[model samples]
Target: MKQRAQGSAGAGTPPGDARVPAQPRPADAPDGFRERDTAVPAARAARGEHTHSERPIPEPRPAVQRSSVRGQILDALRTALVTGELKPGEVYSGPVLGDRFGVSATPVREAMQQLALEGAVEVVPNRGFRVVERGARELAELAEVRALIEVPVMLRLARTVPGERWTELRPLAEETVRAAGTGCPATYAESDRAFHRALLALSGNEQLVGIAADLHRRSQWPPVRRGRAYLVADAAEHMALLDALISGDVDGVRGLVSQHFAGAG
Candidate 1:
């Protein structure tokens, strides 16, 4: 006839033929070739029960987010200390601050521990943490120590760092002036330290920059009870010092540095 539909018997059954039954795959089949358990969902559906795939996925836990929240709390606490919102010597409980910040007490407690390490606050046993009450004498002493460390290094840098380099730092000095205008002691203190730190960095001494920064931070804790006028004046002094350094006026730099620290005390 027509060659008996050529090789049909050798190919077993043709596509969609009902004569052949399916065979199970070999156990050594690769994982990618394995079949999924499609019957489970079908069996559950036949029993009028929900399928496993229909179950909701769980939301991830928030443990990873705690560190970032703790850091924000620490910064806020430091700002409160600098702005006098957290009065010196006053004890503040973690739960109270947590309620105010819209978070749990754990992050607040962790932040307070960091502040304690920075000497901005002290632990008060079961009470919580107390803002460290730095007095005039201690503030003066901190300022004096800062002056001793920064002044000589600045003088040396003034003699060597190029005019263009000092000019480039003008923006930082201007930032201090802008910060002072905010009337927030914390803002001004941060900008003030930034300018000083940048100037000290030109000395190429990482250790000196670190030590001076530490002293500067301690001095700003419960920042001096000076008026906005004092802040503006201090900011202007930064610009004046920059001017002296740019013009290579060693004596002028020395005088400005001395006067700056003197008022700080």
Candidate 2:
């Protein structure tokens, strides 16, 4: 009998036989045991081709949805608070607010928690949240604190921040005037804060801006019973301050800012 050639299947099998079984590819492998295609990736890398995996990355949809819902709820609650719909010193349950806002209790509770942090509400155990009752004394104290912080900063900036920077703030000042003319306290309050924030931002001190903004919001929370004339006057003060700053009139800026906070108190 003829001796089989090396590596032959058997004596009867021819060289390079058609019936020989081939190695399994990655696609043909069973679940949990699929082989990785190392060669194709290497080839692709050498060719400068992208070899990213085809699987899609999962997103945290539920958490994102909940966050958006919570933000909307918080904004609605703030609007209600500003409009005096959520009366000061009144305790309201999360579910009750949720019904009013057409949402579930969870988002409302989350929003109330934020409001508590902002000093707009106080959490009551086993109950819900109480809208914080801010009296005139508190408003006056907030104004005093704000003046102590912002007046010196504005004066210093008025000397150094340059005419162009002060000019840049004119639009924000004008926006406050427009908001004030709307006769809506909430609108004017927000615009008033924006104008101050823009001015403080020129000082390039983020901490100061944040602190002033918080104090300003706290002061504005007590609903203003004053008429539109008060809002208009307040808006005019912003423009006057801008003019003083642009003209390099430190004394004028000082007087305007002091009077502004005095009126606020």
Candidate 3:
């Protein structure tokens, strides 16, 4: 009976001698909840601020970094031509390009030769290479190749793609439309590339993918000059293609896809 009374008294009291005690609490309060977020910005400014004399970005890289500056020279010159900063039918010599890229003539020579091999420029004996001018002929040929390679693959996708696969592409389509509306050319260009790439990805054939990427790169010359793009048609065509895909309209997908390429001219 005495033991029973002792047990009841122990249960009624807290484990510690004191009946009242502090409750356990979380280790730390959430960041920025109670304290001002002053430490971050002030610490960052002390370490380094975006003030002048922070050192200019150094000149855009000179040649000889990798691919031995020579390859760099070639890529730079190609960029100039493709972007229309360089005019067609204009000849450039090894010496001139070397000066432009701040490299020696040897690298410039190397680059020009490579460009000539790729048919990106014309190299003549005893004279320098001319940037090859793009024409409708190339565009039409590219379109023809795309039609041969991609249309059938898309038809296969139209038939083979499950509804779940089709639904996954909705976000890419919306991103394309949003990018186009923003008037950001580069953003739109990427979103534009993404839509076609998503469709071609469905083909699951590596060789077809390589061919499609090459054609798309070559086709950029025409639209880039026009300041608009294959993007508008691409977005519209992708939308139509999606509809046909969901509806199981293989024939309609092929025709609409072919029409999209037809405008490549």
Candidate 4:
């Protein structure tokens, strides 16, 4: 045993105890680390995904939100529309909807008009527009029409689009599943609509995009277990489409999409 460092020894008797001094950390050692050895590849691997050579520092992403009163109103109305809270061919009065929102008729009227324009509601003679009533036949027609106009385009675009681009839609697809499982008709409906919209959006046809929106509006029905069924199948369908697209097999993608519409009928 060696003598300890001199300090408050006047008050103590022990002088033979050796001072256990901490070794100084190397300059390259980050906090919580002891040392860095550049001589071995394993040491470099232990540091991180990159060596002392090169690495990518990811840029921070900006927060996204639904902003603007009109946008918010549209969102709320879309929720109502999808939830089947608004029935087909049923009229929603400006004042009634306004009261439901605890707001004035101005916003409700605006929302109603927008929905009507989207074909979610139809104008009646000497009366307000009814949320467009879709019969089984109408739904079948819509499913078929969409498969016709959108499927080929989706197939083509899917090939050109990278897996990463498709990945951006994965969250929306997952949300559709959650919405269906939880029986959240409103959320389920919006996310369901988004799933298709995202697929069509891959084509970059704004006019065709408008047609898709109209079809969705015309496709609405009362909340039913079938809606959930449709959502689940459609979610899986989206993944299948992506898979075929990634593989660069357009014909296979088209056939699957066509089969889906056949099932829709």
Give TM per candidate: 0.75, 0.78, 0.57, 0.63
- Candidate 3 local lDDT, 165-263, one digit each (tens): 887888898788777666545566567677778878887887878778767756654244443444565666767878788788888888888888887
Q: After aligning candidate 3 to the native by TM-score, how far in Å is the CA of 105 from where it should be?
A: 5.8
**Compared to the true structure, candidate 1 yields what TM-score?**
0.75
Winning model by lDDT: 1
Runs of candidate 1 with Cα error greater than 4 angstroms are 1-64
Q: Report, for every candidate in turn, its global Cα lDDT versus the true structure.
A: 0.88, 0.85, 0.70, 0.68
> Model 2: per-residue lDDT, tens digit, 63-117?
8999999999987787778778889999999999888889899999998998899
- In model 1, what is the error at residue 265, expressed in angstroms? 1.9
Q: Please identify model 3 stretches exceeding 4 Å from their true place.
A: 1-65, 68-82, 94-118, 169-191, 222-233
As for model 4, its CA RMSD to the true structure in angstroms is 16.2
Q: Which stretches of candidate 2 lie over 4 Å from their true place?
A: 1-59
Q: Candidate 3: give the clashing pairs.
A: 64-69
lDDT of 1 by residue, 52-171 (tens): 677675755676589889999988998898889999989999999999999999999999999898899999999999999989999999989999999999899988999999999999
Every model: Cα RMSD to truth: 11.4, 9.3, 18.0, 16.2
Backbone Cα, N, C clashes tallied per candidate: 0, 0, 1, 1
lDDT value, residue 202 of candidate 2: 89
Q: What is the lDDT of residue 120 in candidate 1?
A: 92
**Candidate 1 lDDT score at position 20:** 27
